[model samples]
Target: MNANGPVTAPPTTGPPEHPARAEIDAEENLLEKRRRLVLRRLKQFLGMAVAGTLLLLLNDLLLVHSSAAPSLVVTLGVFFTALCLSYQGRARASLILLITGVLATVGVVLWLEQGIRDSAAVMAMTFPVVVSAMAGSRPLFFTTTALAALVLMAVALGDITGLHPHHVRPVRLSALISLEVVMLAVGASIALIARDLRHALHDAYQQAASAREARRQMEALAFLDPLTGLPNRAAMAQHFEREAARASRDQRRLGVFFLDLDNFKTVNDSLGHPAGDALLRQVAEALLSVVRKGDVVSRIGGDEFMVLVPDLQSDLDVPALADKLVKRLTQPFHVDGASVTATCSLGIALYPDDGHDFAELVKRADTAMYHAKNAGRNALRLFNEDMNSNVVEHLHLLNGMRQALEHGRFELHYQPQINIRNGDIVGCEALLRWREPGLGLIPPSRFIPAAEKSGLIVEIGTWVLQEACRQIKRWDDAGLPGITVAVNLSSVQFKRGDIEQVILNALDSARLTANRLELELTESLLIEDSERFSGLLKRLNELGLTFSIDDFGTGYSNLGYLNRFDVDRLKIDRSFVHDICTDTHHQTIVRAVVQIAGSLGMAVIAEGVEDQATADKLLELGCELGQGWLWSPALAADDYAAYVRQQGRAAPA
Candidate 1:
């Protein structure tokens, strides 16, 4: 393994919350608290008023002469009116009425009775202060307390100055002064306690607000992707649950689309990770723009996104929506001043039809996504029952491959690459084949793709390279003519495996010279990171090892890389050679490849030549090298050695 350090995702901060909304919520809470307090106080005042009215009526009936009857009647009227106002939801009006009525009644009773010496005077002075405190108004509390103190002092001064001559008992100055001191002391103490309680209440509200904000932020971080600022997988699951309930209730359909970008790794490798991150952000924004307002787009992880579309009227709507998404994403994005183009493979699974649960639907959709990628990217596929069987088979194949590798069930077969003019074996391509105990002679097509997808190709490719080198040395030691052995390299091995080190170690262990080994690479690999690959290819070339582009015309056919890299040979794909004698297009393609190879000082080899006519046509096109069934099919190591020996005796020296 290459064993490079892990790449960490960049850090992102949570979005800022709206301050105005928080302030509004806090204000509403305070108002609700004050309303409840006022209502409770009003009920208490109403109860006391009913009891006092009955007592006053009894007193009026018992007394021979009573001067307080009018004041008592007025107090009863004011209390009833305040009750009616409070019941009508006019809390402020009711509180104002109660305060005014209390002050007027207390002033009249003080004048009519024993002035400051009356016990009613003390109740009158403190009632407004208590009510103001309950109302949670600091200014009103202090103002009411000041007015109560002034009334007490005024009454004391009046009694001392003999302003009221109708007193039943003469009041003493020491007693009046003591009463004034006691009332002031009590009022000041109430004010201090109310002030402390208000401060504590304000602090408590602030702390609660802070706690709420913190919890909100934590929820955001838990459910959001930091890089794309979209909903993450956890959020998608929660959203699915909610949407599933709604869809079930309404008898509607829900669509789950699994989307993955194609060739995203090339961007990360060539342009750097920052550009890749920028491209992902642009992709997220574009998906958001194309989806409906109610639809959800979530970033599952790294270049893979899942979209949830609910309230679908019909299953037919999915294809149209998928096309729209594909068209939007396929457009070029400008990242880091480079115009980059990307395509997506989308897989769709519908609720109630594909599966009822989220996990099952996602799995099916993911399977479909791989199908779309396999067919060719920038396309969409719908989940089917047949795909499920394929998934099960794939799992079995992966397990079997692992067991096969561990138990040495894998072996290489060498196919001779023939010289067209001389009819002699020059080199052979090593092809891997698996022969399980139950399933004998498993083809490369069956397991190679699985291995590549599962990342087992790197280990498998390592084994192939080592074995080919050792086999070549054995052939040399056996006194056979020295012929090079070519091994195909998977892109996975080139990128993730320490290929150079593995090759060097294999050569050293086998005692094989570098020139006897040939590496066959795909065209896509050469153009991925040309600069880095150029340096690596140059180093490998300096060691006398050679490279050939395998299946050349099937992939990226840019001629620039032919000159840029240290490529020695071009292997024309079998598709062109299969019908070369009959198809004019195939002949033209082969002829062009031959000319290009000759111009670049490279060799051309046509694969899949089946008969004499095809081989003769290839020779006319100036391609002197060939390999196919016309020569010999791929054989085991021992069979290949015998075949080479037989061909050697047949060749004219």
Candidate 2:
């Protein structure tokens, strides 16, 4: 089909994009059709009601009029009026009009029956008045006029032949003229009022219609997310519940895709939140282009979207649509005058295969999405039950891990950072390890994301900090060495301003010096509330605590703000270290950071060292220290302490 305007997207397939409209024209069309239908019904009802009332009154009025011809005219007028009211598309008020027509016909017949004797009577004046003014309805009024003329001919013919002019004299034409003036004035006034009432009724119906439309719009807005214009979690749940029942009844296939934007936070941090929101809106529009009718899309997370597609008979179509969505979203997004490409990771789950219920399917989809990100993003993953063994087992491990923390089931393992030249143990970074009753060693990374999401990090982080402080204090008490302990903080914990108090509580609890503890933070932490964070950093510095920038190369780095915040060290991310010796660009960046740190009177440490050449190159390049698998792949707390003692014994201090 031909599209209006040059179509920016491929026109042949998928859903249409809605440019935010003042009115949803498609829904408006449905409402307009319904409204007109309702008006037609109302008019038909109005015609019937008025016509019924007039028919009932006809026989009673005709009995007084006496003349069979006049009574016959009255009865016929009422019957026709009732028939017209019963016809389709007649309004109730139109029935009132039918009544008016019956009245006019009756009046004309009465005048004819009374002859010239009663011409001066109200009924005679009324007959002519009604005949002249009932012209609004051409067919009925004309028929009444023609019949009235016949009745007038019969009456005039009878009067000319009457032998005795008992009830009448030579007809007074002047009196008839006076009666005509009064009747015309009365009829015009009644017609004017009726016309005014019709206009008022039309206005009322229009206002009622406008109110109904506004109500629907308000309801729509309530169920939709303002940012994305997609259904929210509440709306999605409602829709899913309804669709699930329908699908179950029909035995159709249902699919849910949980989509998460990859590296979205990095974009938000680097470009500012305004740009991030624009990116989200653009992504919403992009997703809209991939959903068909009978499908729903919802925003369930800050950067996550849920899509529900139903009424499929087979799984073949589900994958194809999911593939289409991934392709469409993985394409570039132009936002805020910048052409930035963003990739969405899709986790697909089908009914009965992935889950038997709505929430279960969504959960499985989420699990698949988590794996998608870990397996490298910009891809789609179908949820598999066999994979759930690993995930379900992993969740069990995580839950056990949390319980262990609650009952002190975890312990700290520290690795020392040695002074290579002097062979002295300076400080150790504290790592967490879980020894389950059945399973073996579990790493921090295996459960940390879950910890952060579950708000368990606060508890785990506190334990690590306090335990590391106690270890430092124990080493000092044994007269082994003066060394510092570095503790990693999660983003959630760091945002807690009372983290200083937590540190102090640990210090006081362990009876350790503040100078011997160093706090480590990554580049991602720098994105929110920089000024407030800088204040916290300075405050901690004043309390005799030191700060280090951890995993520096992985985030948006502003070298301009180093000395301003009194940072003591920069830890290079391991990604750059993997190719530093071979890649000139990588080496240049490392060298520049090393020199910049040196200039700022701060130390630099490169993490993830695996070979001697890289270590030699870093020392040659004026790097302060190195840590990673090349030296050791993390050791137990006791092993680290012994290594520190043995190395300190060999140093020529």
Candidate 3:
């Protein structure tokens, strides 16, 4: 018993619920007790029948009375009938009747015999114990032995009190009590042994169940990624190999996507580690929110997740997935007290075209992701070598632009932000143009997207902010104009948390009012960290700095989301403007974009107005501003200022 101390009948702590399992276990326990109760009653009844027979034999041997023989015989007949009934069923009622008959007969026989130690009455005392053991009920055997002992003691005490005296001598009384004690002691020992065996069996079953539960928990832990509760690398790889094999045999297309969160580390740095972890979980949920039941999403590494699309075909169905994922990520996430914003760049590598093997497919997807990161954050790009060459050239340009930023080859040009109705210059977007000593007058598009990819836009954008501030300060000093200089924001620049501080730094340096500088972003930029990005915009927006989304229709084009953002103008994309004069389809699209922007109280600027026809049509369509080669392409800072001066002289009042 010292194995854990006296195996204290393990407390039934039950289970942890208001609806405990005790009632259930207890009901099973009661059933067994009731079954034993029936067995016990039958054993007692059989014992009584045996006693009645033995008593009749002794009474016949001692007396020559036919009356006593018939009385004993009648008692025997009654007990025999009871034993038959008890053996068949109704053990409780039949056995109780047998017990009452035995006690009364024993007392009456003793009084008639003057308390002699007769075989007749003594037989009744042994019958219950002997028959209980024969019937295989150890508890009943011990209980019967105890009851017999008590009955013998009562007879002995009755004799002493002279009330229905049946005891004759001290020796007879001592002998009967001694026999009863011996029988009880032996029977109780057997019962104690049986109870111990039953308890040991119960303990073994519980231990086996506990071990099985522990095993299941360990197996689950092996598959789970602890932080996000998504599948880990090993589980994901095993799934990949299984699905890849199935797809190969079935001739189904498989899509492997490598998703990297854009600038997630910035949130970790700014908001502390706990907030970062919460943000990551929120992102994981958003990524999988629309996933169907059979699809799988896994966290492969820090800030990188992998998706396996097992059955796919690349028509309208497959190409549509990339656009939907991009849209899902643009919605702002709220965690803790902060409304966090995040975006993911998706890179796709199709089966067989990318690779027949898992490792090869993953590598190609990784290669595609590098190209997507080169394009900009919040964008998706498929794997192709031609895409990489352009990606390589763009990165090279940014590396050169970094060197140029330090040596000073960057210059800004001002293009008029004009009123379409009057054709008067209202404000100007300060555009950057480069004149490298080796290459003359390089365009902004070739270098700007590169600057964004390389994260050099934050610095270059800061330069533009300060330059525009300085120029507007100069114009005010000359009393030539007091107008806003709208500057374009690259996506990378939009990601910076310190964008407001960058503007504040510029405004303080150049001594220009915050009201005179406007920040413009593409609609694609609106799709990233809008909570963080929009907060930065609103801070500047609150300072009277204007906000506009450039290339509006070229983005995901969710006009519903556009109304939720803080902006002053929506610049109609140049692609639409280029074809609006020729294509009726393009005209319809332009009209829709213009109507939506105007309905939201955001002024529409028509970009790429290369001829009078395009500008006149934009004005006819009720656009508020136009900018393109119709007037001038982006120019050098000094040259544009001198040209503006010359244009003012050429103007007729």
Top candidate by TM-score: 1
* Ranked candidates, highest TM-score first: 1, 2, 3
Clashes within 3 Å, all models in order: 0, 10, 1
Please give, for residues 1-653, the per-residue lDDT of candidate 3 as tens digits. 00011111222475554435756876798577656655664555455355635545454546433234555565666677777767777665565556555555554555565453654456545545554554455776677677777777666667778876653433344335434543443354345435545765786688679779968876765866656767766677777788788888989877777888886898889888878777777777766764544567777878888777777643333334554565567678776787777777778777756677778878888787777788777766667545334433543464357557778888888776666666666667788977688788788877775555445578888888888888877876765566577888777775643777888999999877777777888777777666766666667778877888888878787965686677888888888898777888878887887888778888889888898888888877778688888777765556666666765632111
- Residue-by-residue lDDT tens digits, candidate 2, 186-287: 455456546646865897798789989988987876777766667777787787788788888898767788999997898899899978987887787777
TM-score of each: 0.54, 0.52, 0.43
**TM-score (C-alpha, index-matched) for candidate 3:** 0.43
- Cα error, residue 68 of model 3, in Å, equals 30
Task: Give the whole-model CA lDDT for all candidates, comma-separated.
Answer: 0.79, 0.67, 0.67
Stretches off by above 4 angstroms in model 1 are 1-198, 210-387, 649-653
Model 1, span 487-550: residue lDDT tens: 9999889887889999999999998788889999999998888998899889999999999999
Residue 103, model 3: Cα distance from true site in angstroms? 31
Comparing 2 and 3 on TM-score, the stronger one: 2
lDDT of 1 at 33: 70
Whole-model alpha-carbon lDDT for candidate 1: 0.79
Candidate that beats the other on TM-score, 1 or 3, i.e. the better one: 1
